[model samples]
Target: MPVQATSVRAPFDMPGILVPDFRHSRRFQITEFGARPGDKQSTSIAIARAIRAANAAGSGSVIVPAGIWLSGKIHLESNVNLHLARGAILRFSDDPQDYLPPVQTSWEGIECFNYSPLIYAFDCENVAITGPGRIEPVLDRWKIWSARPKLHMDALVALYDMAYRNVPVADRQMAIGQNNLRPHLIQFNRCRNVLVEDISIRGSPFWTLHPLLCRDVTIRRVSIQAHGHNNDGVDPEMSQNVLIEDCVFDQGDDAVSVKSGRDMDAWRLATPCRNVVVRNCRVLNGHQLMAVGSELSGGIENIWVDDCHFVGDGRGGDDHAVPINNLLYVKTNERRGGYVRNVHMSRVTATTLAGSVLAVETDVLYQWRTLLPTYVRRLTAIERLRVSDVHVQQAQSVAVIKGERDLPIQDVRLSRVRVERVSGTPTIVENARDVTLPAAVGRNGASALGADFKNSRRI
Candidate 1:
């Protein structure tokens, strides 16, 4: 059973909830700075100054008055509150360069190449971004990133080199087109005790909002979407305690993804993103409703995902046709060894394309570098996971659990899992060990010789 915020925790059960408590805090409005409503530049400057002032003022909020305040990347300070007035808009500028050079941030748990997000916070304690307003990004930020010719091999090489080298992300010249490649609109790294509530965010170039490597965070009653490449909503990575409740996601990719890190940096961190609960959220136009790791470096444990409606576009096409590719996706990009444990998901309903309910994959980039034990040990594996009382409809297989020989998944159980396929049967399990299921869940799809374990499962 899921652990309640007010209840005690059991050994095998999820830990108690971790919703942030923001009942007490001082508020500072942006209007006092004399910036007119809808003038993005002046208002942004004022907000930045206000954040600094609030920090200097000893823990108070910097409120955004009811209007549009256009901006680029704005750094957040500790103990500062960013409150949005009831009808205000905190719009992000579209020019990619406005985001500036790349910052050292966690992308799936490891330091990587990408632009800083529109609203960012790190190393802050007891923070909150609350409002009943909108955060709309200027799409032009992505336009610059997409202008690069895709066939340019030289450009590709340069990018790969950047991602490879532990490059200092400061004061570097970046290709504008590449920023569009990143989907993070709002991101927080290494923060503690934060609350994000009652905001409507939209139009992302990359992942919508990422809360990476943070602890004790809460996101409630918010509507956020960015229907573009990898525009995932609320990726809580490598963090300890998290609660994401009563939110709605209409995105291009996964709605909510839990991650640690990626490859070596993630394994080295060894920080399992654990004790998470995502309940009563609504997902629309997302491929995976709730996901875990295409890049899980540290690992994930003790999670609960329940009572979510996953709806799709019935008009039928790859774009909007999928409510879920994965209701629960364990995508292990572990270049280092790690373990995923104690996950419980219940009452998740989905409308789908050709995908799975539960996907356990290990595409560890398993090359020669991945063969060594210490190197191979960094690979990701799933242990002791359970899914019960799931009702999946609108035609697809029931579930798929698979892995590689280097990192085989074990001790998986599924009870009362039902599937209604529109075109064909959806149950497929390959290369998994000790897998258990309720009688008569999915009744289609050919069984692999357990050889599909070695089959590739990459994004």
Candidate 2:
């Protein structure tokens, strides 16, 4: 089934979410800073010089003209815009040594000082990465780090232990020998008024666009096709007042994964990710069209997704032949103490789904059970989710909601959903309350419950 164009609007007026304006900023060209195209020499020094000059000028743009530019890291400062004109290709170096001297970054929601992201901004405001060009990383060096060797797993365990023990973030350095924790492609840490638009991202070492502890961020008209391990298209962690619209994602993981921190660390941070809106997006292939994570211990609320189209067949052939796992997936585990509430999605259409159209589960800690000890067991409260006007052509199931017996998901409503074919059970509800589906859901050989929906009420 193909997705049709629909007019869907945001549920409420969000005054805080606005795009950054860099129209009158001055321009600082990289070519003037001794950066030459097609030269095998490293352009890291020149690019850094351009950024430094732009930052010193108080408000300006660091321009990379139409050419193939090679660099190591491109760090941004407040009031500086990194603009890539047409035909500009910014390629990153493959050597790990080029990104030496660990910077303050987060690896899987744990704060640590690791290699800097390819494009990083720390504690900056009014920054942007405007582009009509391409940004790609040399994947030969990063592909090796994707493997989870014993050393990598051990480092993850240690990181978790430190978080459980309340160790300072500065003391948790993860750039040890052969640790292999990859940095993200673009990370804006503790920044405000950020904008990224019109860019085509080819490869990513980790999460493609990570806005950590940021506010008033806007990402629009961007195309991302990164298929590495754990390469989620965009990870909005501990951020607020954000808008992500009109983007194309063909990812190896979730297209848009909303997270905060994890466990004790998140509990201490105490910043819930809230007031975010995503609309007019297209997902070609991904594990989930939209996911609210396994890393949300700091709470997540007020999320709105509207007017999105997902086209995939779970196979690898043409544009409509690829397969998306789930249309909407909300995952949390026993260790997370967050609350997910007030999420509304409307006017979503999908072609084919490999899994359920909607999946809400607790106890989804696939590998953390054996890797680290659960410091605190907290039951997450999930409530007030509404999905409306959704059409799925083919799927394994229409909905699968698995909540804990003690803390059941409450007040979930699905209306105007039209599913052409469901191979498996139509809906499976376990430990939930007030889950109201359309009356025509289970007609025509669709099993509403899987044999395990016990204690579910009002379905």
TM-score of 2: 0.94
Residues 3-48, model 2: lDDT tens digits: 1122324575555554556687789988888888865354677778
lDDT, residue 261, candidate 2? 87
State the lDDT of candidate 1 residue by residue for 1-459, as single tens digits.
011153324334554544434345556777786556667677767778888887886677788878677776777887776888798888887765666667656433446545677788878776778889888888764744545454333344344344345454442233344334453677878887778889898778666777787877888899976665567888888887788889998876788988776655554566888888888998876777778776665778888888887765633223543345778877765454566888888888876645767777666343223233332345566888888888776445456676666666777778877765434444556666777765564444333222133233311
Relative to the unseen true structure, what is the C-alpha lDDT of residue 187 in candidate 1, on a scale of 0 to 100? Answer: 81
What CA RMSD would you report for each candidate?
5.4, 4.5
lDDT of each: 0.68, 0.84
lDDT of 2: 0.84
Model 1: how far residue 213 lies from native, Å: 1.5
Position 57, candidate 2: lDDT: 79
